[model samples]
Target: MTLLTIFSQSGKYLLLSIFAFLLISCSESSPPALTTTADSIYFGGTIITLNDAQPSAEAVAIKDGKIIAVGRYADIEKSHKSAETRLIDLHGKTLIPGFIDGHSHFSEVGAQTVLANLLPPPDGSVKNIADLQKTMRDFIATSPIVKKHGVAIGMNYDDSQLAEHRHPTRHDLDAISTELPIMVSHQSGHFGALNSKALEKVGITADSIAPDGGVIRREADGKTPNGVLEENAFFGVVYKMFPAFTPDEIAAQLQASEKIYLANGFTTIQDGKTTKDNLKLLMAMSEAGTLKADVVSYPDIVTFGDDPLLQSPLMSRHYKNHLRMGGVKLTLDGSPQGKTGWFTVPYFKVPEGQPETYAGYPAFSDEKLNEWILLAYKNNWQVLGHCSGDAAVEQFINAVRNAQKIYPGTNHRPVIIHGHFIRADQVPAIKELGIFVSAFPLHTFNWGDWHRESVVGPERAENISPTGWFLTQDVPFSIHSDAPVIFPDSMKLIGTAVNRTTRSGYVLGAEHRLEPLAALKAMTLSAAYQHFEEATKGSIEVGKLADFVVLAENPLTKTRANLKQIRVLETIKEGKSVYRSTEDEK
Candidate 1:
């Protein structure tokens, strides 16, 4: 690596949040001189540098937001130690590059965290209609949080697996609260379960049939929409019905989301999918310099047409060589568990108990989806499609092929997130087309049992979200937690990727297990590559940003069984200690 010559400040590094909560970054116009050098840098534990050239070290030096050196205690002590330096000895805790959450729904996840944590509707727990009625009564009976806003809003209910195995209709909701409107989003976010009042508010009725890649799931006998609005239908309702959130609420949600990531040692987060408005708030915060976490927000494809940022100052910023703007995101299909995702073949055989062989719904026509894909690629904004089913994955891959014909680049790494059910044959296209994949490794723990039984069935479940399989095929890949969807802990993610064991101890595709070293790369460097941020923050290398975490135990030296038990002790960003374990008992 080309090591740059830069001076660093010599003193104690303090976090902005510690005192009255002030913020300052390493750079602007001309970064303040780093000549006031700190001496004898140490973390009191193992530092597992992700840099392949020099894998482990005892200490790291930082100046001007860039790493000055990474090596052993004796060597660093001999050359860099001085009288005016501040040192942090972690008492033999593990250290590594700060983990990055490659994909997440920041706004939606934030909102969900604020709501009740009740199991989503269409859930197996709602054993019968009475159970569903009880839930509805409860959601309405409470004094509304935003009563002036005029709608009872709740989210993530999967009513499909219930004994009745159906969603609540307008009539059912009318029986409870006819005066106040009610709109509850399904677990998949593809559909909405509403009441008569809400339907009236949105002007949707049995006569209102879906126009595009949407469906109003209806009753077989009356043909009235059972209040299940899929794809376009759900987005349509939420976009209009729900009240806008205040800036403080937005910040609160973001802060709450960050706490979850910090405990997991993740200093960086890719807001996997967001709107231009959300992106604007982040930019305003960063420019005002209020943003704490390094965020990479990839706006949905719709923004490339109306408000393209290829030329904006925010799109091209480098915060202490930390945060960045990489590309655009596209929603291709609905959730597989919701039985709406497009599949080349019909979903697995559901017993008489389950309704239809439902996979999920797609958001666009094959032609329109393809056209949008080509447009995003041509515009120089790398595209990331949320395609999970085999057919949906095929659709995305086909779009990539189409885009390459007219416009092509070697580093263009358009990807498909949550490709949990793509076929084995498509593995070659990832390498041939230079596309990347940031898959959900945590799926092994959360839905491992469901995939084994209800979702994909047994035989094919072995092929689901196989990251290790991609490595064997020489396809570039990384692992992630779709954050509010799964806990955002890198160790937990690594465990899921390397262990493949479910809660019941049944290992899925044992041959697909990865080694600890390989899993680490997927969490760090490979993740940076997906976001086009490999040059700045992925690995702990000379001239790279000094962003890393201190752990309680060295992950590289431990076995897979102990990975999940590890905890993040401190998170350092740009030579400054941003987060430390306040709960650490002396």
Candidate 2:
């Protein structure tokens, strides 16, 4: 071979060798593109994210109890699928973010589960005073709680729904038991009836004067307490009558309450107006790792504002063992349905014993209210004020306004717990004060007729919750079922907000009704915002908690009147099932 031919051949071989080496190096340096795998992937049904940026998703991938990916099913499967991944097929059902409680007494609902069901039809069978007495009699005879506690108690009886349209008097309950101490709470939770024995046990007598913010309902003579107590009068005596439970019993009650919330699709629950004892009990439970769902407590400021525990690390936005002290609760007034909600104008018809000119009264003097609100502000604690009437709302607004003037530029996010009778004029101040309203639109379904006919008259009743006003004003708000007062049925809460229908089938306020999506937002996203947990919960977004609820039917597709018929099939929290209905198995 010639020298030129040898050199040319060698050069060709060297270039070829380098090209092969480059290929090998590139293959070794860059491993196959890594695909993120997830622990679980959910698909095959409608996914309502409650996130405006992505209103819907066909699938979601979860890892380490947080959403890792959300998009088309095919896209998620391509990137997140693995042999270890558990796939969840919704089977044409609906999946949405787990419901977050707006305003409800979680611990009290446990007590309600054990108490006699005096609620009217659909929840219980009590329809009249006689029915209430019979129910109490049955409870006294059959209930293990009564057997152990040695007292008969009934819960959630609405006088408005009774055939008699009047509160069950002590005389009525005396028929159930003059021997056994008996008490029945009004559905509103603002008033209560006691048997003569119960009255004697509580030491409330004809001479017992009503406290500053409560009423002791007098008989026709206007001197003798007729066995009925209102507001603080009921508050002052009711707890005294409750038999203290053993720690195990308390734990069981709390667990039972959590079960109800889980069954209803709630991942986050509230203990509004928690007392000191209950707060301590809950803290112990949280420390013991027994609490399953997240519980945010608003301890009653009037009682526990100065408690050392309130200053502890438990008072934080983060949960320790699924529990936290969110803030403090303040009661500005009573229930409007019970005629003690502190209104600026007289009710459409005065309650039986009240004078014609009587308007409801405040729970405390304005000075005390201002002091309490300012205390919360100075300490940078969020306040949840229970204000049902416009007058009470005004009081709250004024207090908040004054507090802001003193302690400006703190994102306290004060909340109005009920705001059932908030007037149109108050919307501006509510927005300006940055007060978020957790409204009770369930009242429209439960008591619209009573409100229209007796409480506030047709005109004012038309605006009971004022959801439409809030929406129009672009003010953020939330809807709630004041459970124990009514069952925390999420469907019923959403249906009421959308339809505004009364039990009698009357559309109390068509104009005030919300859209289905808006109502859902109120329950989920907006509610989380109210609790200052929007970033971690309330939506099915990447990096958020993997909390979701599966429903038998899509609430968005249901007719407005039928939204309440949608049933929860399963509730999943932190990528694990907490509740699954046996209806499918049956």
- Candidate 2 lDDT tens digits, 212-262: 899898888988889989999999998988877887887788899999999
Residue pairs clashing, model 2: none
lDDT of 1 at 234: 77
Model 1, global lDDT: 0.71
Question: Lowest summed-lDDT stretch of 10 residues in model 1?
Answer: 3-12
Per-candidate TM equals 0.86, 0.94
**Model 2 spans with C-alpha error above 4 angstroms:** 1-35
